[model samples]
Target: MAVSPELEGLRRIVPSRFVSFSFPNPFLGGAPNPYGDSYAGECIRVAVLDSPLPAPSVPSTVAMLVPAGRHRDWIFSTRAGHLHLLLSSTHVSRFIILGPELSAPSPRVVSCVSRPEPDPAHARLLPLLLALCPAAAFLGNARHAVPDVPLLTFHDDLLRLAPVKVVAGPVVGEMVVEDVAIDCAPGPVELRRRLRFKRMPCLVQTQVRLCPSSAAAAAASSSLLEALDGSGGLLQPEVGGSLVEPYLQAMVAGLAVIAPSVDESIQSGVRPTCLCAGVGGGSLPMSIRVGLQFNVLGVEADSVVLDVARNHFGLVEDEFLRVHVGDAIQTIEEFSRQGEADMNFSAVMVDLDSSDAMCGVSAPPLEMTHANILLSAHTILHHHGVLILNVMPPPADVSFYQGLVDVLRQVFSELYEIDVGNGENYVLIATVSPIETRVTDNSGQFLTELRKLAGDFLEHIRKI
Candidate 1:
């Protein structure tokens, strides 16, 4: 992975302060981009350079030199939000560095195309301010300014861990300039930075509370979501693990559409089976409901939670119930790939939610991770399989939740939702086939498509 002379200055390195991120699960979705069509898509061409990686998908070793004209379409990731760099035409150049999210020091933009490797002795390490001279230039033409933001912070404690040499002053990298111009005004400004020492993994020190949920409800959303004033948190043992209304509504609604009355079909010798599953083994309330109605296979990442669910919540591997301990992505991928013929589950209640509100941290729940999860589910999903998702809107940005709804709509033909009694969680039900809209019975109940067996909406799911 020798640095190319042609790309001597196009390194996509981030200043030492920025940190990298890891996304969870096989939730990645492929974003196919076309390289042609008047240079609309960005896929930095590297035919001229002998680089290890290809264009569009920038490898760590390679970086690109893009022009100022096509900056708008080429700046960020083009492949379905995977966050990989894609150049519509890298003939302008191939690249790598700090990804789209974090801001990287800009390279010098010049008309001269020199391919000489400048000697380190002759190369001058510029001051922090000088390093930013070329950044705004290649960012694209409309006007002037930087292309991104500095969202990460440098903790004093983390800074203390760095080597004294790196901590004391600026660190330098080889820079070669053919032709460039940098203009700055006397206003608030930030200089390009490089790390002096290796980054360290920081510890998140925390104290465990015997209580899982706070005694009082958290007001993260609308009033309906707030925990009742007198009601202890939903998990308080005093309540014997109260039922969450949202999950119930979602599960019931999902089952009604997915595994409708087999009683009628059974008499005619066509009994449909319903197999249910939820991602996290949290409390097992959703899993238990699925098990009671039909056979269930629950997947849990945390073993302690799985053990508790088995001992206290009745989650076990039996003729009717099975639980797997692993990432839901892998489990579902396996289920989707293997054993398609014999597997017979009409409905799947997926409560496997991984959100910052519940987990204390956030990842790309909206992008590739969830998309891959849904694609995996689709592999084994019955032609008319139903998917129920427990999507809790995040406290600040709900774009991810909305994005997920859009993804589900794309995967399944028909989609329906039931607000969980709790405002925090909204259960989204999707079916591959259009749902048979329920009708009203004389008793003022939501009469399901097969009303001969179950009278109302609640009763319909109860019977299923």
Candidate 2:
């Protein structure tokens, strides 16, 4: 990772400024930058964005935000030289700065540069960089502990002379040590640990083209729509471990049964809608994958959870996807009474318990019974609509599922159900229209588009 001529040019123009480190990506096992050196209040703080962000104690500027999903993060500049961090969600995180403000002719500026990475040329880099931070905070520190005090002392001396701009892999925040590369520097750099240098995929710099608000909005919308089409409806399929395969397969089953008509309607300028109860970072990712033209309405009962979805999980509710914080059941009833026909959805989905499992914590139950809620969610759907619910059914009590099927059958015209691949959960897809396996051609391939959308879960599905 040699220093690019572009970055070198940036280094030449910018005045020397100090930065403090804040917030650690827990998975990374330690804090990134060490700002232990004496610095004034004017210094900026670099932080790795995560849920439950750490308190910075001082104002901070976002170098980059690398959370999952389709959220884009970049540094935006104005003509007056004032810079802003334009998050992919289009929401701005404010931080006061002593740095220069924008002053150019343009209202904003987009600078495209390669994202930083680790420079392998540095010797004992990982271990050396690892030693920069103390080990008291991490659990596994004692077993892999090295004499970091001496190395810190050494780096302290090196910094006393001149600040070295070092290239570190994304693992170390593309760190710029003052003058010497770690490998060349003198320190007890022993990497007794088995960890090897790992780079995070093929790094591509986020492109920011600063223009009018309209152009920016257009770009973001196109990007989100393109994300589903490009992925073929599969984004990070490994997220939920064993349950993911079946869960997605179930989504496909629902989408499969409705895609033909929904796809046609949208192409003809009739944008179909889907209401997802319980919004997570991956909620929009999942539904949009199933249907590109879908405009999603995400309903979450918890306002805090909705904020987490917006701030942490990158749940941006654009024109295509909208999130509302309210009871799914009550909200649907309200829409029905108001005769908001255009706001009605063709698909209604529920995964209310996703957060309970995701956070490994439980909360009190909602006032409505599960059956009651599902019945209410079904009321606002169009005649050709479908309901996909992710549920936890008792394995021992076969009667539990039987009871649920009975509840849905009372309202829905027909039902198709599949167990998650891991078999921990059941996805019940109930529809108002009938669906059947279509005849194959002479080559024996299936004739219908539904089977293709159903993917591997075709056989797992049962009609009732």
Candidate 3:
């Protein structure tokens, strides 16, 4: 495989920063499941919109997340097979149609952009246009690949394009088609829209504006998620969510380690201590896995998650493993305020909403977005303290990377990005400069150590 210079540089940086290892499952004694169930066999309807129409037909094997059923017109159900596009008018400018095919018994749905009809209103094709489904029911068994999906698009500009409203029908159970598209002209054009269908039940639909930045990010993030899934600790789907502790464990495993106790005597004029934030359930990621890693305190946002973490994840109320539940931001703020005594921390892990974007909302502005929550974590962490921002950074944005550099430059003396498993997702470590620096170039030493740790981590994971 060919390598990008940036990726090669990132690979070299990983071993120096993280000593990668498998996360040890805390639920060794057989307990309640954490992290909920994996979303599997869920069907969703997706409306792919652009200037030119994308492929007209969606593969039966493709798993689509369509809008909920309560909002709009009904679509006829068809087996997870070919998606038939019944355009509302002859003015359709362009559309692509894709067929589903089977390869490895597991359904593989492939779709492409195409110009199926010569109608002139491709621009007016409204939201809820195309639907998606898993090819399980259509193929008898799940298959991996779909064949001969052509890609086409309409480039010709059409004037006076009328808006077309698309809907999914419930009466059409799987393998039947009903009122899928309705013509609504000269109204506000919704860029993305969703409607629920009964045929493909148990699926949640989300429509996002895809851009170069997000597409790049999605590709990078997915690889990391896949890596986490493949690493031995992911709970087996059959074991009913056995993967939660393992996932938590991996977070712990990937954490930056703070040394034992030189800090008690010289720095802060206090005892050496470690802080772990977002302690959902009692699992301590680094401290527990590495054995007395630090005098650790666990913090969480919700009480219920704390309760669940403690009861389900086997994080007993040990004195060293102190667990606190409340608003993580507020808790950190209060900790920062309550004397200088409460503020010191060796490492902080912020995994607030899994990824940067909240799952349910639509087209929220990135400025006020919670995606940058790590900014808060940066404010409170102590010197030489490490902040682990759990985010999936896509490969395409120079600005996003620059933004992180900007933020970390504010707080830390040095920041390093470590990409685990083929440079997919990133774990950023912002380190505080050591106090009483003996070495001439201390920051460079920290960077060197950070890279060594990261590379060791990636190599360890690859071995597993």
Candidate 4:
């Protein structure tokens, strides 16, 4: 494909760096040791400015030639808790730069029409930042400024990658931008399947080590939530789509309600990270929990909405929560490329809308399903990871969702769907088996346990 003139101009101002990442699936989900070479590795070619390659530098603005049989993690540590990147390149591609300085020269925020709320469900700004300026890096110092929002900072001693885009202007397209690697493998696979064949939405999987008494736990009250909300109580829903506040509240409440069961059931503690799809201020409150944290990724249409999410909603607190303001499809791809393989989020909460059967026509189309999302989430989950999804009702024709269940059945030894309420939004949970072999749904232990945990809480979930 030819580069657009606008992109070319953008590239001049903001150069793009390309690096390849690859990984092997040997143990599937066991404690088998990963190939040593796979962990500490080197790139075959480090390309720069259409040229061959060179050594690493601060904010290293250079491309790398990744070899086969090697996963990207070998070169970049996407799982690092904290990262410090130094910009070494002066080529200034997009809003990112590869250099020794941890900070980019000065990032000019591309202004956009004020969005009442950005999609806190899926933080799109991060991906868009990479899309617009692959060279952009976090002005490390500025990170502290946003205390309320949880941020994920990646440190690549050999490099720094940041995203920048021109938000406005008649020549907006002319703005120089850089490119970043975006994995689209599953997209093609997803598009090939029929609506009935589409897989389920992707969910971060976890194991529910529940306490025998978990079912006896009391439901968390909205009053506890009031404490979290401070004097404001539950703020009225914003005019546009500020789902962040309410969503966060419910998410936090849900975790609080379930954590006791999780702790009681399993000796190992649960550190959850949920994924959902939608644009609203609803997820901020969910970002707060004594033991549980979140990565509320949402997919909304507008960029300004993200600004609203950050500005209006109190989403700027910690690094655990982030908003990816973009189409759900593209946002997932970006995460995959960023090394989701090494990520083991405790839980994945999928609230994305699957096919709509109201019109009798499958919305996602039987051939083009969201199964890829499930497959990807499966790859990202930890051992015995639990997967939770917000499901629609039957007769509404959620064959697509069913297809996901069928696929999960093949891998998961146990699966259960509880009527969190009698509506389209039901909490569907799947527990991945440590061993790859399939397990029968016999004995109903899974459901038995799920009901115990859900109990009265089921009623509250429905109301939300």
- Model 1, range 53-152, lDDT digits (tens) per residue? 2222222222332322222222222211111222211221222222212222222221112211212201121121122222323344244343221111
lDDT tens digits, residues 213-309, model 3? 2444435534322322222222111111112222233344343333322233224455445566555334343234224334667666546444433
Q: Candidate 2 vs candidate 4: which has greater TM-score? A: 2
**Ranking, lDDT, top scorer first:** 2, 1, 3, 4
lDDT of 3: 0.33
TM-score for all models, in order of appearance = 0.40, 0.42, 0.40, 0.35
Q: Quick one: how many clashes does candidate 1 have?
A: 31
Candidate 4 lowest-lDDT run of ten: 189-198
The C-alpha stretches of model 1 lying farther than 4 A from their native spots are 1-245, 259-292, 355-364, 367-369, 437-464
Runs of candidate 3 with Cα error greater than 4 angstroms are 1-257, 260-271, 285-290, 354-382, 394-398, 422-424, 434-455, 458-464
Give a tens-digit lDDT track for model 4, residues 1-464.
Answer: 22234444333222223321222222133322222222222212111232112222222222221211221221221111001011222332212211111111222221111111222311423232233322222333254322122122222211111122222212111111111121234532110000111112111111011111122221222322221212122222122111212222223333322343344334444344555544433333233321233344445444554444444333353465555655554555556556654356445555444333122212223422355656666555555555555554332343656676677666555565555332334455565544232222213333234333333443344211
Please give the RMSD to the true structure for each candidate, in Å.
19.5, 18.4, 22.1, 24.3
Query: Which one wins on lDDT?
Result: 2
For candidate 2, the 10 contiguous residues with the lowest summed lDDT are 189-198
- Clashing pairs counted in every model: 31, 22, 75, 107
The total of clashing pairs for model 3 equals 75
